[model samples]
Target chain A: MKSANIQLETLVCPSCTQKIDGALKSLDGIKEDTLKISFATSKVRFDFDEEAVRIEDIEKAINKVGFEVIKSRVK
Target chain B: MQRFIFRNKNKIALINGILIALAFIIRWTAGYMEIFTGLLVAASILGLIPIALQAYQALRVKVVSIDVLVTMAVGGAFAIRNFEESAIVTFLFLFGAYLEQRTLNKTRSAIKALTEMAPETAWKLMDDGEFEEIDIDDVDEGDTLLVKTGAKVPVDGRVLSGEGSINEASITGESIPVAKEAGSGVFAGTLLDNGTLQIVADRVGEDTTFGKIIELVEEAQESKSEAERFIDRFSKYYTPAILLVAILVFLFTRNVELAVTILVLGCPGALVIGVPVSNVAGIGNGASHGVLLKGSEVIRDFSRLDTMIFDKTGTLTQGKPSVAEVQSYGDGIDEARVFLASIERESDHPLALAVLDEIGETDYLEVTDTHVVKGGGITASVGGCRVIVGNQALMTEEGVPLSEQVREDMRRLERSGHSLVLTAVDGELKLLMGIRDPIRPGVADDLESLKKLGVKNLVMLSGDNQGTVDAISSELGLTRAYGHMLPEDKSAYVKDLIGQGEIVAFVGDGVNDSPSLALAHIGIAMGSGTEVAIETSDVVLMNSDFSRLPHALGLVKATSRNMIQNIVIAVGVVLALLASLIFGEWMNMSIGMLVHEGSILVVILNGMRLLRYKLRPSYRLGSRE
Candidate 1:
């Protein structure tokens, strides 16, 4: 498992935050309890299983929810 | 093409807006045109695409969001052949989001400013005595680095040579430049306003104070306050409840238009975003003022605090004491000074430094059999002479005989707020040194300001003698003062205050005060305090300036009041819109959506007020001294 810090381009409203959070949680391999979506900073921090889903897949999932992913760092 | 479309969602919304505007113009000029109806349908469809996609994503995770409600409202309007209402609703929603995105980024600019202040490069001094430019991360501890004029200090270290004026606004939030010379400490992220200096790096990379402040502030902004958590929980039930009500309204009245209007009015957009925005702005304001309120909860608790307890040493008074007078009882006063300075050099007590400071630089004396008595003083043997230096209690324990004149002098000094250290040789009292630590400037005015801010109790606690603590307390006009308190006694006093139903804020700057600091309802650490104190504190005064305390309190009051104002506005708009829909005939789908979007903007603008909050000039009373 690896931790990822992803920055999203300006979450315009709290509803957009809910949409992105929902989309990311439904993706395969994301650790459900580790997900933290900060609407104030437009950043999401989570842990995921690399073997089950790649980092690119997570970004794709966020993009699919109609929000732009600004940058993502893995730790 | 897909990526381009995804990235330019705002531009797509803009184009959809233009289509709606064009459709309205055609209808006004050429009445009842079929092409105008067609254009309206096309604009609504273009706007609904993104909204529908967002709703679909939310549904995949089993969560229904505001986008879902918006999509339903637009689709329901189209089914009813209300092309104008459908086009206007979707366009307004899209445009409102674009405005919100831009404004929310402005609220987050404080953190952006802090991140940008981090120094990226350093001038590392090579072994060959030449400066080489390198990444800050490449610089190691103990490495010598050169900082030129108008450059940022790349690492936290002590100045080795040369001097300069450094603007430490990035670290302490104080705008004024401070003079720096050899042996003076410098921090990373501070700008060297002028001159040049060579420094030895003591702490590098993320270990620097600036790095810690950034990390802490980020974490604090991320943590939710009780009010925020309550709003989140309220929204969890609110959205579903709105859906249930809308469904029941549709089932009973068979009016799809009314049901869709209900859904649009009950979006909870303002209520959900109100609290978090206020918290972010409050934290941002604190960061700019050199006060770090750890989280939203601290602000809530601090604003409500009525009782403040302070530790006397290093907090109410300048912790530095100086020797006021040194009187020798016997011959060889020079020998007495050397013995006292030697033993004091081995001790870390502030009074010991005072004694050494009085007898300037002297030759080292061979000192052996040194022992420190806790809270009393030190005992040592220097050049085969038995020596004891400490307070009256230490002299009494050593069985030293004190003359009548010496006792009179000790009483007068203690009464005048001076701490006396006696040096006894061969079981006879020989030297009496009076040490005085003056009260810090501006303390009196700060106490007055706290009283004005509704602090009912201003108490001082000290381990010093009663006479000294009493004199200092009366000078500061404190409500109460306690002397000769140990660390545990101070903690117990705070606990007693908490038991009495008073919210207490304990302010201190030393390790000994940590227990009391932790026991208080709010722990405030001085910025120049020890590491443990800062870590244990809920709020840190970065420059250790007491004047900021009133400003911090004023901010807390403003933020809490601002949050309440937002809540009332959010809930009020929802109630007014629902009443207009059920009882009046003039309400339409587009007007409802516009009103909802306006309320959201109102609350956001209200929250933004804290970002530019001004501390009243009256609060600066104690700072000048």
Candidate 2:
């Protein structure tokens, strides 16, 4: 298992976090329970299986939900 | 076109506003209903693009957001042929969102400001023994770096060789320049004021102290409190509930305009944003001022603290013992000090260092037969004369007889809480040195400020003897004092106080105090304390400064109060808008959107007040001396 933190541009509204969370949860490799998205800081943190998914795929999923991903780091 | 609409949202809002004004002008001046209606339709369509796109994205995720409510309201107004209301409402919604976005970014500026201060490059030593500039990320532990005057220290390291003053305002929020020399530590992001330093990096990248501070503060601002969590849950069910109420109103009264107006007023935007803004601004204010309130929950708990427990040695006193009083018993006092310094120079005890420090510039005499006592002082023969340097029991064991005046002096020093060091030369009392740890300067005034901030009980707990504890406690006017307290005893006492319905905050700067720090209602650590204590603490006073304590308390109290005030403003405005829509005649779709957005701005402006919070000057009343 690997963890990643994705920074996004400033989120204007609180409910936008739900939209981002739903997009990330639908991916196969993500551990749904470990997902935390903070609207105040506009940061997304989650743990996923490396064998099942790559970080670029997670970024793509967020972009597909209409929010741009500024950067992503895998830890 | 979709990309253009997303990229130029502010532009679209501005153009939509122009169209609305032009339409009204045509209706009032020219009385051309056809051209005015055409302009209104154009404005509504232009303003609806971004709002409709956001609503569609939310719906794709199966969520009904405030954007969806406003979009549906605009569509319903168009269906009823209310072109003016539709155009005005969409323009107001778009303009309101633009303003909200701008002000919300200002609340997170603290994190942005800290990231800007992060050092980006270093001058590292190359293989040829010369220095080369490199990115900070490329620097690693054990890499030697050179720092010039007016340059930032690129990593946390020790000064291999240098003498200068460094401004550590970024690390400790104290802007005073500190003198640095060989073997002294320097943190990343601190500026060198005047000299050059060659330092070897002990920690690099994210492991540096500045890096940890930024990461901790970012996490602190992001973490939610109880009020925020409650609002998150409230808004989840609230937006959909408002939709249901709008549908019910439409079905009962067959009033489409009234139903759409209700949807516009019940967006819950301000209520969703109120608490988090207060938390973010409060945490941000604390970071820039050198106090680290770990999270929103810490802010809440710290504000309600009633009893504050202090560890005596490091928290209240300077933690370094020094010679406070001295007396000469007989002749050869200067010779006795030379013997004392000679014996103490061979020992590395803390008290020994204190005695040696006091007897500066003394001559070292050649001697032999140095014997160590288990719990007493050392006995050594110096310059053909036997010198007994220890406590009273050690003197007695060495067959040194004490005179009547010497006994009286011992009693007097002990009563005053001094750790007595007696030196006897050839069985005659020669010197008496009373050593004690002095209280930190301005601590009394800080404690008084804490009292004014409404801490009901100020207590001290220590491992020292009762007489010493009593003397220090009486001097500071503490409410209670406990002596000879082990770490577990301190934790147990804190637990007992909490059990009796007292909110406890423990302040300490030692490894042994970690347990008590963790068990208290609020754990405040000194910045210079051990990692264990800092890790277990909920609040950190950078630089171990006692003065920031009162400022921290005042800030938290003001922050929590600010949170409550924001919540009231948000909820009260929503209720007032809904109440007016139901019974009053002045309510409309355009007015509802305007007031809804205005309330969000008000709450944000209120939360921003924390950024300028300072402890009132009256709190420093006792600092004059």
| Interface RMSD, prediction 1 | 1.9
Q: Going through the candidates in order, state the TM-score of chain A alone for each one.
A: 0.95, 0.95
lDDT of 2 by residue, A1-75 (tens): 998988898898878898898788878999989998878789898899999998988898887667788877776
- Write the residue-wise lDDT of candidate 2 on B70-112 in tens digits: 9999999999999999999999888887888898888888778
Candidate 1 backbone overlaps, count: 0
Backbone clashes per model, in order?
0, 0
lDDT (C-alpha, whole model) for all candidates: 0.85, 0.88
lDDT of candidate 1 over B407-519, digit per residue (tens)? 99998888878989999877778899889887777788878877887788999999988899988888888999999999999999999989999999999984778888888
Top DockQ prediction, candidate number: 1
- Candidate 1 regions with alpha-carbon error over 4 angstroms: B1-3, B25-36, B120-209, B323-349, B355-412, B421-434, B529-531, B618-625
What range of 10 consecutive residues in model 1 chain B has the weakest lDDT sum? Answer: B616-625
Question: Against the true structure, what is model 2's DockQ?
Answer: 0.65
Q: Pairs clashing in candidate 1?
A: none
- Let me know the DockQ for model 1: 0.71
Q: What is the interface RMSD of each candidate, in Å?
A: 1.9, 1.4
